[model samples]
Target: MKVYLAAVATGLLLIAESANAISVNVQAGRHFTHTSAAIGDNSAGLSFNGNWARSDHNGQLGSLGTAFSLPVGPLTASIGGKALYLSPKDGKNGEALAAGVGLSWTVMPSLALYGEVYGAPPRLTSGIDSYAEAAGGLRFTVFKPLTVDAGYRVMNMRGKEGNRDNKLADGFYIGAGLNF
Candidate 1:
């Protein structure tokens, strides 16, 4: 994991900044895995999907950061981080910090293929481990301000004692978003 993070951090530092516009996303969904905090198992609220998206796993209460959508040769890149305040339904408080990089290819004007890689280490000690996830999916712009995202994600987390034999936990993600 250390090597993976070092590689990504180094790559981000080397990539040339380009002319890109900023967009923000705020959506709410079910909490799975380490996301128990912020948005409990059965809760609905705002989610972070903006500049600091990569860093913010679920929706830490107070999180702030910046990310970029850069245009590569034929695909776009997503890079950013977020630090959120964690508050669970069981009266637990902590923080989750994350960083990620993704790529998107627009095959058509309104349709695109996307993939992302996320690595986030929690700051609080509530039985969560440093995790990493990779996913791919399809995105379609339904309207001028509406978009849909459907994807499957595979992730791995350090088990009880940072052992590597534990089975990884991943899930499928399907939903829509609005651009304002």
Candidate 2:
């Protein structure tokens, strides 16, 4: 846990020092928390994220990713890939390279809706058969550089031996973000 936190902090610091635009986000649910930091403009950027959960079943997950976004009118489309690491308390640890697509639409000047999905096939994964995640939410900009959001996320992993299929996290979360 400490190592994860340190890694995220170091990544964020490096991004802050070199990027003109940066965003940091934090989300929390009943049994899990997610955090991410990114550097880049709306058109493209690199991001680092970490998730931690504590429950009857829990784990830690992290990813480093990059995205290219295209804006058309009031909507944006993005394509990205992430290098993921998962360590579950009761399952095998694994690593995957996943591809993802995302879309976001501006509902109003201060509100927007967004969703994304990521998946990895057996060929791109190790110590696991596959990995998948889906998430969506509404974001409300409270001010120029601050925003709040509510969202739901679900993540799954299939074990190599077909014995440790796990729902890493499946729940709703509320989060806040800072942009600069």
lDDT of each structure?
A: 0.51, 0.80
- Tell me each candidate's TM-score: 0.53, 0.82
Which residue ranges in model 2 land beyond 4 Å of their true spot? 1-19, 43-56
RMSD of each: 13.6, 8.1
* Candidate 1 lDDT, 49-98, residue by residue in tens: 42222122332233454456667655777676665443432234445576
Best-matching candidate per lDDT: 2
**Clash count of each predicted structure:** 3, 0
Clashing pairs in model 1? 51-67, 55-82, 55-98
Instruction: Give me the displacement of residue 158 in model 1, in angstroms.
Output: 4.2
Least accurate 10 contiguous residues by lDDT in model 1: 36-45
